[model samples]
Target: MSDKTESVSTLENAMQLMIQTFHKYSGDEGDKYTLSRAELKVMLTTELGNYLGNAQDKNAVDKVMADLDANGDGEVDFTEFIILVGALTVACNDFFLEYNEKGEKKK
Candidate 1:
């Protein structure tokens, strides 16, 4: 298979592994703790940093927290965390693939 195809397959496998790991650690669907989307976004901001090159901006983090916390709760649950993870994974993969493609073209 071509390199691009291999990279895509690898990313898919990695994402599956992540889901399985989260489930295993947190418990099955019924028993799992679910986080609100807002809570998850806030956690991501703190943990992963804003990918928009503005990690130093506390306002960005606060904004994400505000947007995700629809219920005005203080924390996120597992469901929200998983959704944020999925979104971040896709964005990161796209960025990596594009960066790699550019590097390859240059070489």
Candidate 2:
């Protein structure tokens, strides 16, 4: 690993990457601190890829936009963006736990 990555903890690296990714997309258009629908679409397709279901689908993106826009502001601010990442992390953790348990039972 590079010296910078070798010094950073995994969680810290993850946090920094998340922050960087958000800013990377958020600055594409509209408010620099928030994500417009188009920016969100690009972020999802680029960053999330298949980890998120049908991120390329217009309807799917619309649903995510609606759900994440908790403040009815029609744009996803950093906090709202973090909610998406947090929920996905939780879901992935749960899936990993279930898969690990099943694997142990099979052994």
Candidate 3:
């Protein structure tokens, strides 16, 4: 492992992963810093299939693009992409917490 990677914390690694993943998709076409509709669709299906089912459906992808385009710019920038990831993480954390609490029978 590189010295830099070896010394990085888990949260830092996660942050880096997010940045890399966004750039990976964002560079596929057009602007290198934002995700066009096609790029967003590919990223969603490839990277988030488990979290977001039926990504192949155009309507689903369209809905996601609409929701994430906070600036109405028709493309998802890194900031918007990060917001999506953060929201999904929060949702997953909430789901897991609820699941654990239910299993523990804590009313």
Candidate 4:
């Protein structure tokens, strides 16, 4: 999972990227397996800067943490992180579909 990218399928590569990205932030300040609020904030702002333009806003980070901390543990686990990413992916897909449709209409 570390460096053997040649053998991985596209979906597997995506999964590995998710795992790597989560760990990259999870171990920053608190539990190595979960993301504290601060760690989550850093991860969102740093890793998703383009998608989440104002992720640096304190309120936005707080809202994301509150929504993702499903266990009420004040930290986000891998599953929770995946949920956020999956939702965002779906949203992105929908946006692109709509944009494509609009472009076709204008053509």
Per-residue lDDT, model 4, residue 69, is 89
Error of 3 at 11 (Å): 0.7
What are the clashing pairs of model 3?
A: none
- Cα-based TM-score, every candidate: 0.48, 0.91, 0.93, 0.92
Instruction: Tell how far residue 21 is off in model 1, in angstroms.
Output: 10
lDDT of 1 at 60: 62
Candidate 4 clashes between residue pairs 3 or more apart in a chain or in different chains: none
lDDT of 3 by residue, 38-97 (tens): 999999999999999999999999999999999998999998998999999999999999
List model 4 lDDT by residue over 5-92, tens digit each.
5787899989999999999999888789999999999999998999989998999999999999888999999999999999999999
**Quick one: ranking by TM-score, best first?**
3, 4, 2, 1
Candidate 1 global CA lDDT score:
0.58
All models: lDDT?
0.58, 0.93, 0.94, 0.94
The whole-model C-alpha lDDT of candidate 2 against the native structure comes to 0.93
Write down the RMSD of all candidates, one decimal each: 8.4, 2.3, 1.9, 2.2
lDDT of each residue in 1-107, candidate 1, tens digit only: 45665455787987777666544444433335543334343444455765645645667656655655556664444555566567777999999999999999999
lDDT preference between candidates 2 and 4, better one: 4
Clashing pairs in 2: none
